[model samples]
Target: METQRNTQSETKKSPQTQPHQENLKGTFAAVIIVGLIILLSWFGIFGLFLERA
Candidate 1:
């Protein structure tokens, strides 16, 4: 029972790494979104294509 309590306490403390991980995740997501927008625009302005078609 004592070992079980210690294990639980250690697990709870590991959450300190989560904020740094979340920031990295946000940065990665932003990069991907911007890249996709640039690619789509370069393919030829999508709205103008639709208007002319």
Candidate 2:
């Protein structure tokens, strides 16, 4: 019974790493969004592929 309790406690402690994974996923999404905004702004300013008169 004591060993069972110890195993359960150890298993519970290992789950703390899950939040770090979630944080990385969120940060990655933020980076992609910012990058797309910058790219679209560049295209808008330069007017790439516009019809040349």
Clashing pairs in 2: none
Stretches of model 1 off by over 4 angstroms after superposition: 1-22, 45-53
* Displacement of the residue 8 alpha carbon in candidate 2, Å: 33
lDDT of each: 0.82, 0.80
**Residue pairs with backbone atoms closer than 3 Å in model 1 (clashes):** none
True-structure RMSD for candidate 1: 6.9
Q: How accurate locally is residue 53 in candidate 1, as Cα lDDT from 0 to 100?
A: 94
Native-to-model Cα distance after best TM-score fit, residue 41 in candidate 1, in Å: 0.4
Provide the TM-score for each candidate, comma-separated. Answer: 0.41, 0.47
lDDT per residue, candidate 2, 1-53, as tens digits? 99999998888784444443344788889999999999999888678546342
- How big is the RMSD of model 2? 7.5
* lDDT at position 20, candidate 2: 39
